[model samples]
Target: MIPYTLPEVLRLVWSLVWQQIVQHAQVVAWSLFRRHHQAVAQVYHYKRRLALNTS
Candidate 1:
């Protein structure tokens, strides 16, 4: 069996954690991008209605 030292194990875990963080950030970014475009389309269809609905 291959033996892994402590720092090696820690580095591996850290890499996995960073990957998850990056993936979550990508999902949040895509969601915000979609919402921004949706708001833009709403403005084209209903300018004042969108503002009124938000307020």
Candidate 2:
């Protein structure tokens, strides 16, 4: 196995940190998207039910 130099070690650490940050951001974004979609769906469902009840 090749022994890592200081720069190489730093680079590897930076890469891992960046990957983890990107993954976390993606998870947060998806969670928010799902919540927004669910909220919109619920609103639509309620509106439809209200219209049917009034008709």
Tens digits of per-residue lDDT for model 1, 1-55: 7899999999998888765555888999999999999999988879778878999
**Backbone clashes in model 1, listed as residue pairs:** none
Question: By lDDT, who's the top model here?
Answer: 2
Candidate 1, lDDT over the whole model: 0.87
1-55 in candidate 2: lDDT tens per residue?
Answer: 9988999989998888765555888999999999999999999999999999999
Global CA lDDT of candidate 2, please? 0.92
lDDT of 2 at 12: 96
Give model 2's TM-score versus the native structure: 0.59
How many clashing pairs in candidate 1? 0
